[model samples]
Target: MPDMPTVSLNKAAPPPLPPTYQDPQLLPEPRRCDTGAGIVWIRKAFDMFKQNIGIWLGITVAMFAIMMVLTIVPLFGILSGLVVILFIGSFMQAAAIQERGERLKFEYLFSAFSTHLKPLLILTLLYMVSIAVFFILTFWGMHLLSVSNFLEARVALDSVGVSSSKQWIVMLYMLIAVLPMILLSMAFWFAPALIVLHDMAAMTAVKKSLQACLKNWLAFLIFGVVGGLLSIVLMVFTLGFGFLLVMPMMLLVYYTSYRDIWTDQPLSIDA
Candidate 1:
């Protein structure tokens, strides 16, 4: 029997490991939050806002001024809508930064502009089309109504010593326009966060946002009512200066709601 020689092999350390690729599609589904969570989210946001009110206020004011300037540009005034959507995503990013215990910077105000500008701009265009279609339908409905009641409308106007459908048209448009706009606003509420934070496409974000709203419509309804009242009171008490505080806090609250839903975890007060 011959003894076999055992050879010891030196194994070189494996080349420095490269970063692992993560699955981008592994996003968590949004959780169902209770109606009370709306107020909790608001409180969380206000606490976050208190940490750097001055910076938040400055960012809010700057955003306002930029949007105002954009609004005044002639022949290209429509560009402001796109700018507004981009800024909304930027502001959400800003809130996310603050939520993560990072120092908020002025640059966060433009973060989305660099990262998700095109999709956000397209989101704005979709929003515009939504509104425009609603407006046209409203105008058409009013036209039909006016035609159906032409004689009665004329008699009523003559009784009031007024002539012309212009006033009625304007009134009808105002009344009819608000409902669709509010519905659209709710549906689009979470789209920016979904697009910027989750890296979703415009239409995907819009659809998911709308579905999230529909699923949580009751909570949103309560939040809207209570939050609207709180906003009015805050605005009144601070003589409009509160807007500087309220505006950013509201945005943070919005981001909080989106985070809570999408991540399936509510942020703690201490967080």
Candidate 2:
């Protein structure tokens, strides 16, 4: 009988290509969008708002009521930041659910609490710290400017009919000082969505959010300008009550922008 073909088991089949290595912590690289993409974000957000107007209004009312209650309780108002973070995450989650063709539910407003409470809280803490640092630095810088002869120069200029009031100078200083805070806001803009959707840590989420915003600064600039103008119009036409509507729409825009920049599929609403 032909010698049984010698079967060589010497080589374990090369370890099945290590199951496609996937990093659980991997995050998407933020995309740089065209400047006009800002307007597109608003349009998409508006479409989402139209689809769930009733639920959106209800969530807005609930948010206002809760925030009012928190504000009424002495010292508890500080928790408002945490509440806002949770609400933001919930809004992102709701948008995702709605994108799946499901009807929006009021309960979505509180859903983040169960799944992402800790990270949301951490975000709030970081927010508070940022505010504190802003104030501290602003005041300290003002003090330095005040003592550095800047005030004297202003006075001399005023005396020369330059019409520079100390109040105006301070206002200008404050406006200039707020530039950094605006950047900080950009850093934090997408953090809640990142935390809720990606399960990213607070710090990591903030860093990524900032990078995303910086990469799309032109788009954000357009967004800011258009949003500001729209807000003014809404406020004027509706006697400030428009904020209730504006607030929800703004949150939708936040979610839409996050989806646009970080995910392969952006949220869409049917015409």
Candidate 3:
């Protein structure tokens, strides 16, 4: 018989290693960026979106679908905040992967659930509590204002002509009520990314995020104005369909901003 060729069994090659930066590191204090950096962050995010448009769209749609489902189901809507936190962390992870030249996959959307779920959930709970406190205080303050207004109006009716509707009181109340929630949002703006990327504790991450926002308030103001205008334009031109693109881009912007402010090594636009 002809000599049989000897077959050698070789083990499958090990899977490629993830990007080294994925490992948690001790991040420095957030940097204060120039106002122009806001526009740069948005442009970089758009570049990231263009690099993997299809995947970005898919992730956005998936997230929207999940949120809708949660909203429609009774009592389950409460979970929407938790879902948002998870997705935020996942988006940060995806951004990191893309920054390293890796192709972003849809599977990355759920990666946070495995690695950072607990802390993310804690963040969500804290947000919910803050919202609840806001609503309670708003109602209580409104009631007190109404009573005071009523008493003052009666006094005015007896004295000079009837006072105007006291609309200023309502305006003042609204301003006061909104301020705390704005601060709450600032505290949360970068907390998820800090927890996901730097492995910071929940409270510590919230503190850092707030400090970062205050440190770079000018940049954030610019970012908010530009992003708000873009959102309005998209909604007007696309009749709301543009949210399919805007949603993902918003997450990418967040990731880019976090990287720019929190890390010594920020992602380049070209990257």
Candidate 4:
């Protein structure tokens, strides 16, 4: 067989080989507060707080009202109302962020109710399932102890030839109940991030939220514990001016974590 000449991009010979294409970088540095990314975000959040206070306050009020109703009303189907809120959140939140300069608005959130219903519904189901799991584990653990208490214990031990202390049984159940508090916090730690950043379906956002925490389990658990302790301390000291600091800090932590994992892209400087 004759040896074949190499093809090249040079016009005089064969065309030169095409250049290799490069993909955009993944796993870029997250915008950390130490890098002043958090500072810029703090500024933006300040603007967000200042301009969207009324919107947020109103939404908060509406939500609180719904919660109150759920607690007070029997079979009023308040779970359904919660789905309404999550759906409304999709549009209301985006509009509130975008219209931070507008200062005051009434019907902006109403529009979200109709427009973002699909993703909102998915998120609602996800949230419901997570909450259900949290409660189920909590109650089941409690019941497990109740069944093993006193009379039940005497009956079971007579059959099994073993014994247990009331204190130990109670303590074990307490630990189980408390475990959900931490799991619930971490499980939904990225809920808002998934809802806002990825525009993921509710089930997926919830699952991803759980996975994100598992991947960064220690940090996420520490965040909840420290954040909770600090919030209580601040509440004691500042009569809730603390929320001005607390809310922003909490949001920043989640936002930074989400950016690091999902986007993993550099932020462009403001033009």
Which clashing pairs does model 1 show? none
Each candidate's clash count:
0, 0, 0, 8
lDDT by residue (45-155, candidate 2, tens digit) is 898899989999999889879988998899998776569888888888888778767778999999999999999999989988998998899888877777896877587
Those runs of model 2 whose alpha carbons end farther than 4 Å from true positions after fitting are: 1-27, 149-172, 267-271
- How many residue pairs clash in model 1? 0
Give the per-residue lDDT of model 4 (tens digit) for 151-181: 6655665567555656655666678777777
Taking all chains together, the TM-score of candidate 3 against the true structure is 0.82
Q: Give the better candidate number (1 or 2) by lDDT.
A: 2
- Looking at model 4, which ten-residue stretch has the lowest summed lDDT? 24-33
Regions of model 1 farther than 4 Å from truth: 1-28, 149-178, 268-271
Lowest summed lDDT window (length 10), candidate 1:
21-30
Q: In model 3, what lDDT does residue 234 have?
A: 96
lDDT of 3 by residue, 1-271 (tens): 8999988689788899885555334457777787778888888899889999999899888987999999999999878767998998998988888877788999998999999999999999988888899899888877876776656645655576654455644556678788888889899999989888878899999999999999999988898899999989998999999888788888898888887788877654344
Q: Residue 187: error of model 4 in Å?
A: 3.4
lDDT of 3: 0.84
What does the lDDT read for residue 6 in candidate 3? 88
